[model samples]
Target: MGEERRGISRRGLIGGGAALGVGAAAVGFGAGRATAVETERAGAAAAYSLYGAHQPGIVTPVQDRLHFATFDVTTDSRAALVDMLRAWTDAAARMMHGDGAGPSGPTSGDYDAPPDDTGEAIDLPPSRLTLTFGFGASLFDDRFGLSGKRPAALDPLPHFPGDNLRPERSEGDLCVQACADDPQVAVHAIRNLARIGFGTVGMRWSQLGFGKTSTTTRDEATPRNLFGFKDGTMNVKSDDRDALADHVWVGEDADQPWMAGGSYLVARRITMTIETWDRQSLREQERVVGRTKSEGAPLSGGVERDQPDFERAGREGKPLVDPAAHVRIAHPDHNGGVQMLRRGYNFVDGSSDIGRMDAGLFFLAYVVDPATHFVPVQMRLATLDDMQEYVQHTGSGLFAIPPGVRRGEYVGQGLFSA
Candidate 1:
């Protein structure tokens, strides 16, 4: 109902003129085929609702592919920006339901006009797609008169030890994280959204990722990063309501009321020295990660799910889980009981000029507050984690993810409300 109201009556697909409209219709790919929305509602599989108390991607079950993009708002008109968001919201809702970005379908629009939906994902399943959006610190600048509403917690992340941040690939006025079981589907979502934004927003930087490195569901097995070591063994799960409330979801007393049900996102593009790491002995690798490479159990060990025993010592009377081990330093025991919902992905962008694979973990974490939940832990990891030897933080971002939307409401509507 909300989508119908906001979608369907939009005109162009690109350029300045089209950026002013905020509607996109949905359609079935072929004649007689049920629309994806209908098939999903029929229970062909589980589908995540676009309208909710919190966005879907954060806590939704991890998908197989990711297309994460950040954009620079080129328009100075607050009205134009707001309209673009509403358009994005409409497109996102339709796309998540396996419908096209616009109701005209990919080929049914006027012969002379550009098609609203990019036809790439035609006939593809929704693939459990989810689109999560956020606003960067720079968006609060005087450009749109939102200075006072900027949350103090939305401050830029401080530079950390061993950071080799590349300015060209970090930060933006807006961000959209598209994930789906099909890589093409994920890419399609981002492509259409970018197409819809056209002149109003320019793509700043983007990352394509595959093989989710972390999961938000307990039943799913933990996944390994590029280093071949299991990651996020202690991640907060979707069903852990208590943990979600305590660590991931923003509370009622947050500095900005607009972010009450939302969470903060810290994105770090960590590039690993694959060649160097591959040469390390198995024992050394396990020592650096503080877990058995194959099973992911702590060095002090019971099993993968058992709490790490940092105090346990070996025959040499040294801590079995090395003090500098990643698991040891990043453990909640060492970080004042803080935890985050990790939803990272592994990425490989071919090879570097030196002939080494230019790839690593595109780290994404959601927390109630970065100040207490992320910064300190990362600082410790930057200075103390043994994994730092092979990994370098290359690009980074901090975004304020607003709460979800109800039918007929745009994402981040709370921020614009008087």
Candidate 2:
């Protein structure tokens, strides 16, 4: 798509006009070649393709906003569940293309029947919206005759040392991750998908996130987490195709063939103790995160992009980067060089019962296998990281994100086929 095509305005999309369509042809022209209306239209139409080898949301550029929801399968009938997946797939495809969720769209002359779309995003652009769906381990229960089809790698995550998990917000049978530059666009996608699966599935828990916490591509600058520390400095960028294939995408020889190009998603709701962290000295804070607050550089010395010198010595002959520092414990070198793609967001939910702010990072990671990639890494952090004292893991989930859908096929079609 041209730069002009990505700039189409919401008004231009809702009210079809020649000015908006003509703007795309004005590229490389001099002054006054395109009207102001045309310019607005060209700027507002950014979108991501929904059909691909893998889901768009996994490796797509991280969006500014997120609406992630998990659902429980309410019906025991396999046909009903399959039908709902198909319906959801269709609606997702339409919504991602900047179209309404259903055939009738935002409006219809037939007043007696309810409109198919929720009408909240009628005039908005797609904003690079991407809706990713995944199946939880619980979905493979005998309820849908999928007991034997469950990928062995989809097993439930083992409980860690510092987890204060709440049962209500933990796991679900399915998950939908909607991300977009426009908050309304992301919310609308999830709301409509839930509406489409009304009778067959019920929402378990959901999270709304803002201010992305990491960068998935090399061109973008790294973002900070709620703790005011730059996160994912060594993250596997989407541009590194080889790294993505080895660390994120599942191979055909995986436990299940249906998950060939798919990946595993691990979501953790980590609540930060902002009050306690704020009271600490700047030096203490830097020690905990193991990076300079101003430059986000390693304590061992060097620029932000330089590799940390873990063996460097300090004033008292102690390691410059403490062994218990958050960065040190979570570093790939400390672990087996195993890394996952981190696409998280900073969240601030009003307050707790005692009046303290309920805010932290909603950690989301995509990996080839959680068993080898996520489990051991988290295990080390849970026991050794000093940052754990100021944060608590309150909710968690794991899902097997299936491969992308074709034009005519539905999500998870491979599992249902003979």
Candidate 3:
């Protein structure tokens, strides 16, 4: 694991100290050459470890772009599915390391044979690419004889109050979450994986997201969602090791041992009523969200990071934070101390017939158990939050993300091992 060897660049080999010394000795170079050398060294440095106790994308630094896809297992053969998983695992490792999908890359020089990689990301850096896989509830439905191995916590999500779900976009048998700083790099990873999965698994649904809606580190400025509110202000950051272990990571003695280091993933496509929200007054909007739009501070407020004083009163002894406010209902203190790692992204999928934007947040959350962490919190939000009137939950999915693989192993090998 010496940084996984994400392909050495030509600049790294030809412009380093030793290489520069040799070049200067052979042919004395000038200022322009020196500038070019420095420029090459200053190029993007983005790479993440592909092998670890848990998957990289969940807790890894939140990338700016996302390409999320879900697929159905078309082949009935268990062996065929396993084989495809192996292929996908290998391809993911190579892609994360900035290499091509297969052994022979795009420039294999064999014109007669098809190229393994699609050639889009040939000269691009890794961009901190992460490919995370998960198993949906349907995957355990007597198909591939995996019914017995399904985790008890992998139950399907219940319908919420303002849900207008589309069956076609809601669920799938398997899911692949690809995130990267560059949009093209994220797309390249998914395209190559889908190409490799042909004949075995076919994509059921997909979503493209840009401008991350949350921040997972203290150094990162809190990002805004479609509603223009600072999102994930109290999120479980990578530095919060204790919070991650307690709220995000699965325990050692869990329902399924194979999923010890893994966590449950919940994906929701919330469509915003943009026209309606646009007409609302600033006071009404702030009251609904329970925070100041400018500073993102709680209405009971001091500053952005100040703990919300829920009991504080304002005019005529009225509660300062609205009882039905989004922040009030979704606060961890009110939800039995339950918190999720939110890494969502804002998305816009064109427009409807009336020209209203078909857009909202593609919410992604990782929790130790959705039953305890997500279900209760969402249940409260769906019923009590005043913000529900301005948004609709159009798509939903739940998956069991397995533990990460070792260098020589596949993604879900532990489950397959007898």
Candidate 4:
């Protein structure tokens, strides 16, 4: 954290970081003692390009782990903030390729000073690591003279029926979503970034997630949530270009030109009442989810991928998929044909105050506009979905994701220059 005492000017450090990041892209290390010691781990890691039409984490195949962090801008200087972002982007590009945070390597850095890289991920593969960044509503404030550049779609999310959101766990000026197959890889990405941002930014809150709750690729089997029902079975997939265009990516028509090709992100930390939910009968659970407990078929009868037939009736002439069921209430058909590209993960943060499991879904979704794709669907779910009783929206954030960056350009370059 004492980056200043490292006997180097901050600007020089940032410049060197960027130069080393670019050069490290094609660098590879030979098998060493660490690899021999950790031979049990995964072999080679799959690396994704850090530069593209859109950020990697949003539509990239959902990873097994996530380390999502939101940060507050501590410095009022726009130059300082920009420099920190450039440093972050450089480090992220290098790390995604499984390289050290700095070219000097973690342990090889100057012995007299703290290491440039954290060294925890030294022996790890990239594991398809991705670092996606975004700007929260608060980041558009007068501090950096960015008020006019604020996108209308970045407006604060409205409160829903039963939200018990905690202030400490809520919004921030910026967010960085790191995901990788290895938990250590994801954790190391955030830790190094936080270290790099030292004085310019302060981490407001962070969430560690394991066991992905949604699938962005159709080939992977659908995953179940803590409630034991298939979550995001009908999620928008990376191959569905039409759906991504219609519901996820911001296009040229966006009110803010700088946001074109970008997307809006909504994160909800839903805490489930694990004990109470576990007590519910099998039939009750099935009814709440509108899907069979075993195969995840719609209550109306079909395989996991079968669309829910809302009009189907049961023996008593009542709808087979309950009118208030989560699947029914939050379906695209019911939400003005809107859908979200969800990439959430399950998390168990030890125990609660009363000794119950402190676990739930860390719900993350990408949409073109939350106004059309998220708010209304969530409103219906909050008010009518039977699953509402078992889960509480405890933490929330809305961020404006910038388009992918080009080499020599930092993330969010458009917003600052526009």
Please, what is the TM-score per model? 0.90, 0.91, 0.90, 0.90
Candidate 3: how many backbone clashes?
Answer: 0
Q: Write the per-residue lDDT of candidate 4 for residues 182-288, one digit (tens) a residue.
A: 99989999999999999999999999999899998889889888888888799998878889889999999888898998999999999999799899999999999
Tens digit of per-residue lDDT, candidate 3, span 313-406: 9978989999999999999999999989999999999999998999999999999999999999999999999999998999998999998777
User: lDDT values of the candidates?
Assistant: 0.85, 0.84, 0.83, 0.85
Q: Enumerate clash totals for all models, in the order shown.
A: 3, 9, 0, 0
Error of 2 at 151 (Å): 0.7
Angstrom error of the Cα, residue 136, model 4: value is 0.4
Q: Candidate 1: where are CA atoms >4 Å away?
A: 1-46
Top candidate when judged by TM-score against the true structure = 2
- Model 2 Cα lDDT, one tens digit per residue, 58-129: 877788999999999999999999999999999887787677888666555245556678888988877778
Q: Which segments of candidate 4 are over 4 A away from where they belong?
A: 1-44
Off by over 4 Å in 2: 1-44
lDDT of 2 at 325: 91
Model 1 residue 95 lDDT? 82
